[model samples]
Target chain A: MSSLDIRNLEIHVEGKPIVKDFTLNVPKGEVHALMGPNGSGKSTLAKALAGHEDYQIVAGEASLNGQNILKMEVDEIARAGLFMAFQYPSEIPGVSIANFIRAALTARLADNEELDAARYYRRLYEKMDLLKIDRKFTARSVNEGFSGGEKKRCEILQMAMLQPHFAIMDETDSGLDIDALKIVSHGVNTMRGPDLGILLITHYQRLLDYIVPDKVHVMWDGRIVRSGGKELALELEEKGYDWVKEEVAVV
Target chain B: MPATIEQETTNHSIDFDREVGNFKYKEDYSYDAGTGLNEDTVRYISGVKDEDEWILNFRLKALKVFESKPTPTHWASKDLESIDYSKIRYYLSKGQQPSRSWDEVPDDVKETFERLGIPEQERKFLAGVEAQFDSEAAYSNMKARLAEEGVIFVGSTEGLKEHPEIFRKFFGKVIPTGDNKFSALNSAVFSGGSFIYVPPGVHVKQPLQAYFRINAENFGQFERTLIIADEGAEVTYMEGCTAPKFETTTLHSAVVELVALKGARIQYITVQNWSENVFNLVTKRGMAMEDATIKWIDCNIGSRLTMKYPGVILKGRRARGEVLSIALANNGQHQDTGAKMIHAADDTTSNIIAKSISVGQGRSTYRGLVQIPKHLKNCKNNTECDALLINTNSRTDTYPAINVRGNRNSVQHEASVSKVSTEQIFYMQQRGLSEAQAMSLAVNGFVNDLIREFPMEYSVELKRLIDLQMEGSVG
Candidate 1:
């Protein structure tokens, strides 16, 4: 069983601390929701966990299946079974979606072992179909000129294809319509199984209604202040973030 | 992120020096007209080819023209001034006629081309193949079906001697000897370029390919090519060139002229990967008649300095012209390439798309010209030049001269210079590609649109070549 374990992680951007004393763990077969207000450092934590160069880790330990991921490169971290669905997917002009995914899969293979193109395409098409993405999109450049919903769906498509041990979806619902949100949620639900863990980071609690996280945590000022079950999301939605700020102030 | 965030970095200049390989070949030249160019050299070259009197006289006149004209000094790069005419071997040949079969070729020459995969490519897709070693063609062959269809493909010397009636009329009409200094020099001692003629109403479905290799030290390769397509005919010609590395500088100057008659279409493609010590200066132009089309697809890589601008003249009503070029300049190289389009008739159209990449301390320049005179009616022209810089020390420049005087003519010119973004690199790296692979993919992506215009086999080879160039470019 694989897990993403982060303990006492302190991340800084340009020498200014953004995520301080952050600790979270999501084991396989469970989903965790990270709800935070703006400037709460939720996205910072996600990017830092993915080994973004700009997000300097001051003190932290992030392990993937007993492997120290914080010491690895960004790509190494990814190959170690951690996936981050970006808030903004980059537009790689001229690189087809098929080629991008193939490159990722090929990287995981041993040297001198080539990815079987036919099998790879079959799997890719299956995942693409599950996400309601057009089959013609396989030949299109990755996320180039794609609509907002399309970009989000593409990220989910990548997460589904990679089938990582843990996936951190950052604002996967932003810029998505109700139908797109439903499709994305369905994709996420389909990928959630005994071997995969998920951490959904969002500013709003709306996404929680669809994914139905096993645990919900409200973060304030770079640290999680409260944790509860699924009902906590609806309660926080009704009470608004001001209540969380007051609660954190009392703490 | 803002909709449009301009993140411009100040250019950081750095010095870069790369050691070029010094690979040489040991072979006997049956005929070697020693170094230096003069009337004697031109006469000797003509005598060796056993050309007609008019051809020899033409060469002698061109020799005078070459001597009179000075090396161009106003270009973006001053590498032209360094070419020493006296140090260059004017001509060398293996003293054997071009053979129709590979078995008939000299053993050493055949082995060289076999290693370069010329014969294999011909067997797979080409309708004909012409392999030139040094100054003369060592092997030339065409499919029997093509030969039976009245299509003529052979060396220029053979074409002139065997079919002068057809070859003489249009030989230098498209590109005159006095067109440029290099053209003049090429005309004086030119040898071993492909000569093709397509009959009217006949289409050659497969491409005819030519491979040129320069093997001697301090050698100068001056090949002259002429292609003519009759009315309603269509054909495509492709050329590939490479040279062995040498400590001393080598010069390659060629003149290629194409004539597309009424309703005919001709496409010319060149993929040049010369050694770093070679100076490649070429003059290529095409003339399109009524309702005809001419297209030039040129790719330039390697070579210490290259200045080539393939152009077309739309001389008849409703004629069309296009030039698609991709130039890559690695360390210590300069790729100065672009296109020229001349609209001389009403309803003529032309298009130019040029993409260039500069790696390390290399420099690439887009120098182009488009002219639509005042009397031309309903003429249209579009030109786009894009440059990608791969390093902090790399540089690029654009110089486009668009002259549009006609009121009804439509002209559009667009040029862009962009450096490979760090975000792009990081994004690709996140997908598990190494820095070199990411760089290669991004560079390939930048020119992907234009590369699609190439034939399938060429596009694949071009990508492989770019990948090799980008392997060690990033630290």
Candidate 2:
């Protein structure tokens, strides 16, 4: 079984530590929710694990399915079965979503081996339908001038197509309306199975209502201060983040 | 932080230099006018062509004009000062007539065009083909169906000899010998370029193509082309050019004139991929009559320095013109290209869109002009220039001169300068693309809109060229 393991990790941005001594282990067949407020190093951890050059890994280790992703390049980390769904997807003007996904899948092939175009398009159309995306959306530029809901749906669509061993979803619920949120949750739920592991990051507890997480971790400052089962998310939602600050102060 | 990004761009630009160089071909010239240009060179070229007295006089007058005019000092780049006119060979050719069959041409000459996929394209898509080797066309042919439609496609020399009634009337009328210094030079010693004429109300469905190859060292290629689309006729013409890599500088000066009569439509396209040692200076202009349409689509890549501005004159009421061009300047190259629109009649409209990319120490500039007189009522013009700089040393500039004399005329000009964002590259990398692939995709996207304007086959070829250039730059 595949798993993503982070051990005593410390990440810094511009020479300042953001995520300190963070540890998390997500095995296949389960989903873990990482709930944190703004500037709590949630996005920093995601970027660091994705091998972004700006997020410096100071005294940290991240491995995906027994492969040390920290030693690999950004593209290599992606090809090593780790995916990071961005909070703010970049706008690639003139590049269609169909071509982008095709390139990603083509990268996974062995050298000199070409992807089967007919089969690839068939599978792509199927996944796009499952995500409720119109076939015309494939011709539009990647994330260019897309609404908040469309961007989130696009990220989930990519996750479904790439079928990575582990996916780190960063703020996939932000800016999405109720209808869009349900559609996005449905797409994510449809992809969930015994072979996939998901790290769902969110600021509010609303996302948990749709896709129930097996584990919930409260991230304060730079580390996870509390962890529990699914009901903990509801209790934290009712108590508010101020309660977590006070509890951490007491600790 | 900006400095770091510039450094990365510089490192990537070196990769392109490694990818394109050292392409050479064997040279065989039966007649070489030798280096230098003067009355003797002009007289020799005229004598070899056995031209009429009027044509010979025209060459002499143009030679005098070329001698009187000096190279402009106020260009976007001062590389023009390095060109030595006396060191340039005015004419070089195999001294053979153009053949309609590929087997009749010499093997070496045929192989060059074959490698460039000329014959295959002619068979598959083109209605006619004209392949120029150095100073003269080596092979020229048109389909029988097109000939039956009264479409005239032949070398300029053949056109002048056989179709004097049409050739003489519009020969130098659109672009005169004194239009520019390069035009004057081309008028004096010009040799093999395509001459096409479409009959009235006839439409040539497939494109007519010409391929120009310069194989000799220090040789100069001056081809004069003229196309006349009669009233209500429609046609599309395309040309591609290349030269062998050499240490000594080569010169390519061409002059092209198009006349679209009343209600006629003509589309002219050129793709120039010269070697870095070649200096490409060209003058192309078209005249659009009442309700006529003229369009110029140009793509420039490679060459040490290129100075070309294709222009259109809307000389009659309701005439239309458009210019869509793309230029890429790699290391040690400068592309100074743009368009000119002149609205001389009522209800005339024109549009210009130019895009350029500068990598390493390369430079690109957009120089354009638009003129609308007070007498012209309801004239409109739009111009857009976009520049992409790939490194700190890469540079771009825009100089637009617009003269609208009437209050009823409307002219809009827009320009933008941008670099490939690092964030975009990072984002693509997160999707499993390598750094080079990411940069290539971004560059392709930057010009994607303009590329779509090209014909299907040319657009595909352009993408492949861009991919190769990107790989070299990033390597």
Candidate 3:
């Protein structure tokens, strides 16, 4: 039951099909790389599974830990242990990072229960120290005036605090430079364990060089065209996605 | 156009009912001036208090002015026509005496104030406390230490009789009867508000608090408050008003005046939570002298229609004034609130920041006025007003009139109206918060800076009031 499974999932954006027959499954304790070029529907699939209102799910089923996720509301789905790190997270002005994460944690509590402030700060500081984020960042507003690298680190910081069962990293490596990439990759590698299954969506194989995935799947034309080990990423990087397109065409 | 009057049944509901200022006890009155507003009603009230001849003439003259002027129908809301002046009880009180101790107060009155958490708050932080029920102050007391420093804090009636040398000078000077129709009515029938005077260089460290409660049906509560801080003195005064829900409409019109002399400071704060059946029309203005500072921290949460624009008149060189306010308007309510700054001398400065949140069909309007005459120099003002509309039906408007004639003066004004974005709401929702909780969080974020300007206890209570009003607001 501790797994993420998507079975023949079909999705449309503004009445046009963007993800077709997306079938994948990742058991807990594994990292899966969803590799694709631009417009290959990797991000659309993540948003659809997370129940974003703009994404339409035409057919098929998506479940997490034996619970149907796409059938629930957005917040309910999140409470059922799903987290998405946006490529461009919003800037919540006037709300500090400490308060924002506290609100999220408070929402997870029962009606009669309350969050222990001292305990929460202790755990938050521990995570921030591990991620190498400055202690003063706690007082700063969430992603407000943050650089691209800082925003991604903030997302990982939230993930570390929330402790979600499964996470979808939507291009977490898109806007980072080489040095920032190393720090972020180290964070992802540290968060990896049997308790959390991750679907890492990326266009290039540069990220896999740092945090190697257990399996890699290539997507093209809104469908998965190839499935292989980490070596497939290097092969695609060498021969490029054109070879996969021709191979799929020949099939 | 004088609109017709009709009694509309209470239709829509839900703004923190039953638990927060929604229960009223029976009324036991020793004096009632009957219904209607006339010369006889004014005379009857003046006679009950055994007022001076000059005070009686002032009341009678104000009653004439009240009858002569009309509601500003051409510019005001149509809801103003719903108020029936002939059917309202003008005056009602148990007695003119305000007990100096809670033990001497009536049981029902003491129970009412206790339930509202008055005495506890007084004991916790206040330097002085005045609890007013219906038409008179039930209990008024100040710390003995403060009294030892020659600080005068008492009901307006007692102040008028005991300290006329100081009270008679600035009684109605700031906001006279003919200033507006409501002010005229309040001047004619004003009762149990606070009167405070701090001596020169005598600083009151803790705030003096007054809590006003309305307990009778179809009665109008008109209180008058005045405070004068002598040269080099500093004081902060806070007041709260609450009333129970009733089927008929209730009117609450008050006039408050403040004076900060040279090198002095005065801060006036109000946290009002009137029921949906009340119409709160108030006039509040302060005067700041040379090198003095005056600040108004107002938070308006509940009422049927509230029209208050707390203003400041800078009357001396190097004087400063500031007004920071937050308002939350729920269904069937309209908050027409803003600020005014009048620069009367050179080197005067003022700043105004107002924020409002409109939920459901509620409406909020920000009307500000800033004036600097051509002869004045080095006058500056900065005005900003922001509004948040919760849903599609929720509405907000802003009208700022700024006039700076002299080339040496500088003024800046900014206004913005934004709706709660679905994306922002969804972002908070995806963080595991319900829709209403998410909305409340965003609103609190919108007004977070102004909330910090409030005192510790009021800020907490204000946040709770905002959360309570945000219930059932999500469409």
Best by DockQ: 2
Question: Estimated TM-score per prediction?
Answer: 0.92, 0.93, 0.94
Candidate 2, residues B1-475, lDDT tens digits: the string is 1121232233322122212224556777887888899988988888777888988899999999998988886654678889999999988888737999999988888888777778878887899999999999999999999999999999998888889899999999989999988999999999999899999999999999999988889899999899999999999999988887889999999999999999999999998888889999999999999999999999998899999999999998999999999999888899999999989999999999999998878899999999999977899999999998877778999999999996998999999998977778888888888887887788778898898788766766666677766777764
lDDT of 3 by residue, A171-222 (tens): 9998899888888899888999999899999999999999899999999988
Per-residue alpha-carbon lDDT of candidate 1 for residues A1-251, written as tens digits (9 for 90 to 100):
37888899999999999998989888888999999898999989988888889999999788988899888888888888888898988888888787788777888889988666657777888898999999889878989999999999999988888878899999999999999999999999998899999999998788888999999988888888899999999989999999988987787
Error at B201, model 3, angstroms: 0.8
Better-scoring candidate (TM-score), 1 or 2: 2
Model 3's chain B yields a TM-score of 0.95
Candidate 2 segments whose C-alpha is farther than 4 A from its true place: A110-112, A115-118, B1-22
Q: Residue B252 of candidate 1: its Cα lDDT?
A: 95
RMSD of each: 6.2, 5.6, 6.7
What is every candidate's C-alpha DockQ against the true complex, given to 2 decimals?
0.33, 0.40, 0.38
Candidate 3 stretches with Cα past 4 Å from truth are: B1-19
Evaluate fnat for each of the predicted models and list the values in order.
0.55, 0.70, 0.55
Under CAPRI classification, how is model 2 graded?
Answer: acceptable
Q: Which lDDT value does model 3 have at B323? A: 92
Interface RMSD for model 2 amounts to 7.1
